[model samples]
Target: MHRLIAALVFLFCATVRVFPHADKVEDRLVMHFATGGHPPSNGRWEDINHRHLAEVKGTPTLTNIGPAVALQFNGYTDHMLVPIKPEDLPVTAISLAAWVIVNETMADGGIISYAQDNGPQEKGFALGFDERSFTFSLATEKADDGDGKLTRIRANTPLTAGKWHYVVGTYDGETMKLFVNGREEATSKEQGGKILYPAKGRFTIGAYIDDNEFHAMDGALYEAKVYGRAMVATEIQAAARQNRALLDHESSINKELKFVVAPYLQFGTRDSMTIMCETSAEAQMLVEYAERQPLVSRTRSEEARLINTVTLSGLKPHTQYFYRVTCTDKNGNVARSDILTLQTAPGPETPWAFGIIGDTQRNPEVTKRATDGIFALRPNMTIHCGDVVDDGFAKHQWVSDLFAPSATLFSHVPLFPVIGNHEKNAHWYYDYFHLPKPEYYYTFTYGNAQFFMIDSNKDLSPGSEQYRWLEAELRKSKATWKFTCHHHPCFSSDENDYGDRWKGKAPEGFRSGDENAQRLVELYEKYRVDVAFAGHIHSYERAWPILQMQVNQKNGVRYIVSGGGGGGLEQAAPQRAWFTVHVQRGHHYCYAAVHDRTIQFKAYDLEGRLFDTFELTKGR
Candidate 1:
């Protein structure tokens, strides 16, 4: 009888050990810009095919010159602007992509402008770049009302050097988005007002109406594509990650980057399976690199060593799992690899919680300290509201400011990051994280809430397709709570930012600059959104339930600015009619708890002492 019991126990242990095989998720798509690409049939603006100086005609050829004619640039370096007639093409969603090697950096960096004209100066929209960093921006105005304003959504990354890099700008009336390579790095919005033009003239590129002489492009331009519809995030990433197909298993033997998926994997189990690793290099040399790792679980095979890869499965859906990479080449050699982590989707059945962090660009040490604090609190997941690394486009700074300091915690946490104005490389943010949407704006769910992670640093207007999508999402959500997080603060107390203040100084719905700010605030109020958070100002603040200045606690949504994840120090605003509570200035990390009845928030300094706290009740 005792022997029989032991056998049964062993069988039970083996059953529990069975692992699940992983189903592969399709890779995100990235659209590449070769030269002379064709626009959608609706494209009518300055077609790259009909250049005034030289015809760049072609039918979306991979190269610049072709027979079908793909895109057209104004080439009006001498002050001549390209004009587009509405009859030529009417578009609700548009994205512009190109590969450029700048001839020289601008002395002060002025506008390298792209404008939609309604006859010379009647009214229209304009996008430009700052003189200092080749950062992109947007400016719009109504020629008749003069009520339009400029919304500058600066790219977080830099446009420097003579290297080839992909750049894309997308405008869906409601949201302006910018992508580098294939990753979204910035987003912004214009309120309800139009940067309306008289529509009498043509669209222009490179030179503005204000220029004295028509200046032609000084740099090489390649692969410019304009799409009439908003490009899906997944489609964009897949294109970006596409590489020349290497020789298959049946082909050559000289390849070095080939990776093999392991066998005996269960669909949803924690069993770590071994992957047989071998290279063209001698087995002994490969073994030398393997034995150095401590976490690598391996065994000797006939041709190579079988090392286990950490399998993150059977987790509480939508949670961050911390892990490390370990491997063995041959000869019983082992080495410890870098620690890494991933966030699992919420179990197909329920919702979860996550935190937000942003702009740790100024003071990395403080950011590091805050990161430790956030990890200690243990959120199901986290979000960096852009600018986690200053000079984000710069490779070295990204390592020091973001990766190095945050690695310890990041390895254990799953972070869903949004594009900030600081990331510039087409692949700057992509090479770092495994995001659900390779592009900048994405949507995810947790518990009773649906979160909209958007880009507020580029030009997305309200009437655009992005806005239409947002409306559809809000309408479809059955979740009890709705939250949105982005970088720039819509209404903040940064006294230096005159744009945030509205006291008769500016009309309520008037050109307060970036009407999207005003429009978003209005939408949140209308939809009964529970909370909205933002970070650009580098301080911690909370607004009272307010709509058009009248305290509508019952219906008003709450707005919080918690950008103080250790960037440049900033002061907060004092008590105001619209402010329920606030922490104008502090060096702290934000904490949140999603519970049955309400969503609670608190701010903590590096020492773990609570500096600010508030409770937001939830319900119909």
Candidate 2:
């Protein structure tokens, strides 16, 4: 009985000790939207002091700040409603705070949009954010139509997603201020004068609400607090120091790491393959697999890391195996992943299938459709020709736009990617994927075919590093089928990207097929490369077999421009060029089946429409 009573006492003490601001000036704090809660779904957060209570709606996921866990809105229909009697509303001087992580930028996202109307009188003000920047808005009056004419001041720092922030906005009768983390970012003296409160009011969190519809927030809010009196700079700064401690605690939630990017396969050769994943914390990773019996392997890095890669070798060629990844943080807390599978490459005589996509950027929804379609095709492997993300430097897009859509496909199949112009040769790309030395250009052989991945963003002309490497590699490749892929099309029926030949106008900068990449045409012809693939035009085009820039069906190379991965669809040249055979503008992915001396390829749009098909045979 004594031990249970002691535990209860500790729990009571912990519940009340939520924030530094509240502990410092308990009487001045009107409410903290999330005072004490377990991984909350939806319920009431009543002020312990009996001042106010917030009604939660929909389900907000749990998010942690420091040691405190708060709610994260889904940006669609999640919100919290706080009713404030006239006596509780801050009328003249007010301060608002939100510990947040914003996922998307929006025009009217309300970290807190406040307004309370009582009969003919309005009694509240709103606190909202611009995402890229935070804004503090105050108004002395509202229009008769019931809209506030707020005086706004903005902070400079962009509130990027996937990180924590301590944002504060305040208004004292003479000045308005906005602070991020703990330092002052902006100030304004526009609204000034006395603000009024009516007989009753309301303070809302997670959304902007009034007589107008609610503008939901696309972020996680660790806490939202209201102070009856505007806090001075020194007090706010001191409170920020305490916030820093809380954020430090946020480093690892619940004492364990989370899977940021789930386990996926990479670099699969006949006898070896790599298993990779990323976690939120620097943690040691262990991978277990089974072919006929269970086997274990540790990550390559001796030190802890957010990215963990495990290579499994000495396996049978063309064999399948099931595997799972486990992450263990320093505290010994563990996270385990579901079991998945992978297949090793087969010998040259075995048949194989693969999927190809290009320019998968900016549109994850469409990308998801394409990826799902590809997954349905059950290719043994996948290739992203280039432009994997809208900006290769923006690491978040790599997860959101590329990896998310990859879904079940990547879990089972390996991916080989080239560097596109959009990648900008960012370090994140290199860190995320374990590729060969000089990652920008490399070659891989699977079954009977060999793929040459080029970095079109670099100089591929004669004498350039990629040019010399490709010439040497192509000459040495004795595979039955040889294919080359890059970002810029060697032959595309693209209109403006190439010169606007229909109007007889030279392109401002770009041309249809890259002149530099086109230089490889001579090399491809000489080496008898079967097919050249690229994506930059955001459409699908296949050129007639050509040699020496002229049609040569007997022994010439074919060019395919399959840019329609996820970017907005683009158009082909107004009229077919001399080398054009088929051109279709749409979002798409391609799948191919290969066997000795024969290749069967097909293209499909997002809705699973089989738009085109063709076959290539050696020594036909």
Candidate 3:
């Protein structure tokens, strides 16, 4: 009886093909990382049961999200390498599945890959993202290169940030498929034959690795599994269902996502204009612009990065163009801006108008109201007299206090700005604005008028570099009109700028305007500058054309202080100074339209009340 029973049991075990205590799901997995490497194998990630190990390349930390533990890549320099043999990867069919959460948009980075080369074209398989486009990549005999000629496939889904996702990519010998959240999202049939692969390649996780390790990913990665055979829709769905339990807690973080900075125009000229916007997280940027037709062009970052600054070229001079920006995170979340329009700079002889404002610091509501007035006028461009933000170092203020409030005006009008005292002379100003070399002090001529934008925060004394540049610029300019803009005033009559006369005539030390700024009066006198615009004090003051401390309407430089853009109101002296012709204390913006040698200058308050108007005309 014992002999018969033992013989029967042995036969049953042999036919059943049973050995380990793994579940059905685990039985099919050729290699698996259960806890970013459970049973923590020193500094390596050991497969759940298989001896296939991955050498941790960079410093990957551990994070416990909800009920699961994951490995975190720093995005800039973290990855893993599992040495893989040709036989280890199936030649006919294979599937790769992972639980991933991307921290930012990987403009060009890999999630997991085992490829032959690193160039645009290679011979292998990879799952990655580039320029807002994310997909599964597999190479075959029919493919021309590794990446471009029908070598990659992506779903129309957008990748979002701050959420865990289960993704699977597979090849079933005839078709390539991508599954997200257990559902098939994308499929292709170009790679029909056996997959072409590298003999001594390594399976890279959380980064792009082919010839070498290049693009590293940021965020956490959970169990990643590999199967030698193609995983059917049911198997992928089952696997995704199992992984979904651990992500129930982290699913609410995306409910209140912050948007990127509003789109703004910059570096605008006759033939080009740069449309710029910044994302809260790293994102791939795509800018589309059109003149008369649906002219579409795509742009990708040289690498996955944070800022998108694209210059639209081949634009027609004095022509209007419509543009918009779209940003995509690696997880397929997309954000797009509204379409806006801007006209390129007209020729010097063209009749055009530009608006000017100053001191729009720390007052959002007033700033918005003041800028709306400017936008309605539909000027060719807008000029900021400086102090765009109260604290230049606090980077967020640039978005809230400046960009957000003036979004409407800036979307359509390119802004030319001068640095103000409130800007703190920080590098952020230079990074935000795209201008000529040494952007702080530069010159650009538009529509018969030449503008010299000066950085009064820097030294403007007689022997300073700015002095020499101004001398050379003004001496050679032959435009119909010449204008100079600096933050500090060359002439002012604010209550205390000249002197704090609490109740009397005031003390010494204080002058009519900034002494350093006043020193440039000779240049205005010598060159016969049309207007000297400034914005230090928070009030509007239009001085009579002054030549040598006297009002000379014929050939003197007219100085105007349109400092009422937004700020606490200030008053003129108890007794008005000589340079002050007209003064107003309110939030306002100024507009100037130049036709031939004549300019019509008008200033209006937030109520749309024209408080000041003047005309300056020159002879032929």
Candidate 4:
């Protein structure tokens, strides 16, 4: 009897070990494709689990990466397939993860999918690309009253093409989640119950199962993995961190020429300013400055870094200084920037002249001409109302279209720029320009005028941070004149006011029929703002002192749209708005001369023609 009990106990222990609880099971499949062994022409990809090997279709090449290998897909007809039985796929919980490097933008493509076909009844899951966003979907038989439906979650921010990114999709029975770069981007509820998978369906990588759909990936893929159970947030984050290390390793392989971007100015003030520049290699920076043409004072930064910035203080207000920057790269290459001049802000009660320009995208030559015209006016400083480049992400645009064309003007005069939609709130804009605190929206005092630069791309309704800050700044301001600059005119008469191609639908933050616009107008009236300047219509428009959308020249505010700074021109509406006093279609800019309580304004076209002129007088 004792021997029989021992035998039964041993058998029970063996059964428990073989059939653990479903939640306790840690079943996973990892595929490091083409990393070590090359697949045959039949396209069989071996998996680490040894249970299923993928079948390759079309033509895919194996590229050597050090001692390992990586698979390349032509994005058209190439794909890797793995036949999976219904029982092999996870039903209650699952996770799919991959590291991908997209070659270019595609209309539509699948990265990984288990669906049988593109039909509505196809039962499985798919992680794919739709336009610029990454999408994840799950098909279930019970989703839509037994008719079979798909539950999809998309990443909040679009993924940039031609870059390496880590993506993961998981379903924890009750919730569906999508993560990008270790951060949870999107989530969906009501995804409980088991997932549906067709009995004969095959798991596909880099292409959909439907041959006629042409939804194939065009990129390089590495380190693909799948798990039967949904991975917790910490596990997914750890996978992303590991992928980042691999990306860093790949980036460190190439050593190219340095000095991609030239030296530029930032944080200009009455007595201090900063000079910033970028280099491809580590470098030391030196700057020489003096009041005269031949610089005498020298400042040097000993620390070596790719991005270099140095501040110069103890400067005299209302004085002009000449400076030059020199950098010594790690490889002993020395480069010197052009000698430039900087003019400090004038003291209180001093007369000052400043220029305004806007919408200079896609017209570098025209922008150069306008800057020359503004320089001819000899303004002490400049205010740009936004849209500085056609594409803020394109480095060449900033160099050829903006910096190179306006180098002389930028070096001599401090520029206060408003955030434009075209800039896309890119980090490069923030890195290049140094504005007041909370740079997107801030106020600065120059002479007897207080200039406020705001980000019209953001929410500015009553309780918004920007709106509250603006009200406080206006209430506390003691300057004799107040001026605000931003993209999107507060009172435009151009076709842009009618929306894109006259759809009659305005942009969210734009001035026409927008809550932000109405709130801003009320603030302007209450504060007795001297003038508000804006761009984005690609034309010139000036409104009479307007209050509550009507002419109130006594104490109301003037709204001007001077978007004609080199962008393609747009015509004013056939029937102008009631407040529109003058409007013109041309590439132009505005020049303002402020003296105590009076401001003389002039608008000029590219040909140096003075199209509009006005004067503002406050406090008698």
Candidate 5:
């Protein structure tokens, strides 16, 4: 009897040692991606918790971390997808955790997801990056139509590219929480009963399984784990704490490089230019520049700050210059940027081309595509009619949504922007762009054209300061061509009209129409402006030369609404207005060439298809 008891005790001890956390282990799915070999040769990646192996597609490489393994995705077609089963679906509460090292910031891509098959009626959860922010989303079917409606919670801080980050998303039946770097960043109240799963659901990594809209991640993911039960904050923190040494090593390497936003050209003119960028910390900034040769001239900022601006003066007109920026942090860690080139504005009557695009606020991918199209045209300069970002106060939106995507374009071509309503007159807009004095409403002359960038969000009454200043500038301008760019439109047939009425009664003081539009239009007409560009509506509309609401092409001023610059498209009214000559609903931009006394305008959609073209000759 004693010998039997000893055998039983030994068996119980062995079982306890094998299943350390048996109670929690049964409700979790852990995938280490440590398939001992590379892809194509290594058929599948097994989930250590369950035997549910995921089929690897495309050429996914492998990397070693000490004795462990991690998968490297190419951001194109690399993905690991598992067929969904009854055991894979979460019933009530769920948590997803992953360690990722993003190589580049994408528009939208999933890190880990489980989604339904139907295109629009998909129901599931995904942890990914919406543009640049870490986001956790839950999609539920509508009670009426069964269409999917998404509820999302995004982290306040953006994840740094080329760095490892620990991310966790948890839903406890009432509230959804998103944690980044082991700290809670955002939360949302989602009181859904049970997580919904469609008939053809799938669990995928590196991309959305069912939707083609979301892009694949361009990064490396390690140790992806999912729990059927809600994971508490302590558990998530503990998991992240295990990698504290790894994160600290990364942080030390990052500190060696102090630059955050690279040096980009801004506020360029014939004899002057501004080089602006941001560093990771307070650093002394300097720019060494010369004309098409080794650096000979240097300009240094007097103060040490994160945001560095160095203006180079005495630059030759219509000349190209090579330059490089260097920054040194407090720790004596020096960072040097790549060599960049910049060309000053052309001399008067030199025949230059400039591009116009606006409302590039919400969508970064569309904005990048449109900017690339414009860049291919090789414009001397670019003009943005405001709404540079969806939320002006949100600094992340400016960096990720606007600045980062347009960095390449704006680095070469100087951008003169107007203030849109979305900016809310925030100081961030003023701080970012190096505009003329009274940055909101200012005029700049490029080549033979004098461009007026107005703040349409503020009051533009006849007696207002902006109105008076605009009148004075117009009266004094001696340039051959005069163009005005603002946010709100005096005439728009699109559904986004501020007052709903497209053709309203003209106010007494201003002849254009009621509201601020009337006063602004009167100034444009009185000043004999060649063409006025406005972009509040999210569609392209070009009006005939209208003077006092009448189409008089001779002395009237033309209005072109080029608001379709990456923002969501808006549909125009069915019945076209008398002044509306051409209208198209799509993402588009305008390219204008000025030579002698004539200006040629061509509107091209995102695909480079020319939809509208017109020429204006100044009656000299």
Candidate 6:
């Protein structure tokens, strides 16, 4: 009984000590418009009861659309505007936040927009979402430019399945940021002009003009606020958590993208480049704010490897550009070292070549052999299509198999590494190398084809998230050859055991089966996934042009299991009919030659003698 009482007392004390930001003051204010019996017509009042307004829910019943109050609009000309007199007006930096549910995209001709009195474009910003996909669009216009600048942030998933979400925009002198559900989604500093004037115009909740098509907000809205001072990321994150509990209790929420993919395209005229890196963690948790921001103006996070990313601006594309990483130690010491160079992707006329390797396990010496061969060939870049290391993230395994032998070669050539089952155990792959998201799956476009890397070991089931992502990525591709690489071979020789190893024990959230492999095969048949590669069988087995296990001859995906890089030999068992091609048990590497018209593959033994060759002719 005494121990229980002491535990309760300890819990109370711990709760009291739990404030992470007690020192910093939060500049926040909230206002609610309570309408009596009748809904006010004038634009002065921001109505809190959306059901009466008819913005979202109907007259008979109010659909509790989470954060928003249903509003109604009668074809009136003037719009609704709420009085927002900040305690400290004209504060240099500030944040404007609100919750909105748009049942439809912004009306075209009526022009129900968000505007302020500062400048024409500075008037206000407008947000629209396409109903079918819930694609969001935010536009800012200036009178001088005549036409408004529109930026769209498409949600990977739809929002209007009756869900309430948070949207916040912040202006910090030079940079303008847009956040969705309290997570920063996009940013732009390329505006030619400044914010016309102080945020003096009346704060408008819905509709620019009175009773415009966009009036009274067709959807529901809940908590709204505007701060005179720029709220740090911690404040926003905490609010997001609270909002999730208060408003959206039963909706599927995704963690925000860690960082945006900074544009890689550059030209002779551009002097500097700005790369946007994202982080799911709050800025306060970052270890080195300077290294994370790098732009000199922002001092946000203090964590190393925070999602908030490093930006490299002022770059000359096509020219050799060198950069160094800036991180910090536990003591907050700035550690900026290891200068690296990136010779940006060549211009339209330049022809480039990259090599491909798969499954360099069993023998660490295989990395040396493959690197030596690839180096001799003088390929501009190299891609390891998964299974780089043998087992899970054992630190020593990486040293012995990956970095040691291939370090020299990789340092010279731009090497793209994918997540293999072996590389997933420790999550050390991202620490050693800086690839894109470091997720088990990702996509990148190369010279003529686009490459997709998937984590087959974890989840490859039909209708799974990875499968959906693959379909979306494949659909968005402009490349003629959509090449996919994973650690587990989708198709392999019956000789060496091939198929799903973790067939029954996939994680709870993941789908079961090599369904992804077969489904991918079907998708390849439909969308023309030119070549698929895998490494796990420890042998070199190539598939003939096949669709649903039948010979399509012309338009089918060819699977290559090149697991014999340095791994132990596993001979391919003989299989008849359209399913089998030449299966070799020799210790060899594979090379692909891609041209505008045709792509050719040659499997060569360690002695540099070609054993098997195949070609893919392009369509008219």
The predicted structure with the larger lDDT, 3 or 6, is: 3
Candidate 5, pairs of clashing residues: none
For model 5, the local distance difference test gives 0.75
> How does each model score on lDDT?
0.49, 0.75, 0.77, 0.72, 0.75, 0.51
lDDT of 5 by residue, 309-330 (tens): 8999999998888887877565
Worst 10 residues of 6 by lDDT: 260-269
User: Of the candidates numbered 2 and 6, which has the greater TM-score value?
Assistant: 2
Q: Best candidate per TM-score, number?
A: 3
Residue 82, model 3, lDDT: 83
Instruction: State every prediction's TM-score relative to the real structure.
Output: 0.47, 0.59, 0.61, 0.56, 0.58, 0.46
Q: What is the number of backbone collisions in each predicted candidate, taken in the order shown?
A: 100, 4, 12, 1, 0, 48
lDDT tens digits by residue: candidate 4, 504-619 = 46452323423455568888889988899988889888888987777887888988888888788888766657778898888988899988778899999888999899887776
Query: Which pairs clash in model 4?
Result: 43-56
Q: Cα miss at 483, model 5 (Å)?
A: 0.9
Task: Tell how far residue 137 is off in model 5, in angstroms.
Answer: 61
Better of 3 and 5 by TM-score: 3
Regions more than 4 Å wrong, model 6: 1-342, 347-349, 496-516, 574-577
Residue 572: error of model 2 in Å? Answer: 0.9
For candidate 2, give the lDDT: 0.75
Candidate whose lDDT is highest:
3
Off by over 4 Å in 1: 1-322, 327-335, 338-353, 499-515, 573-577
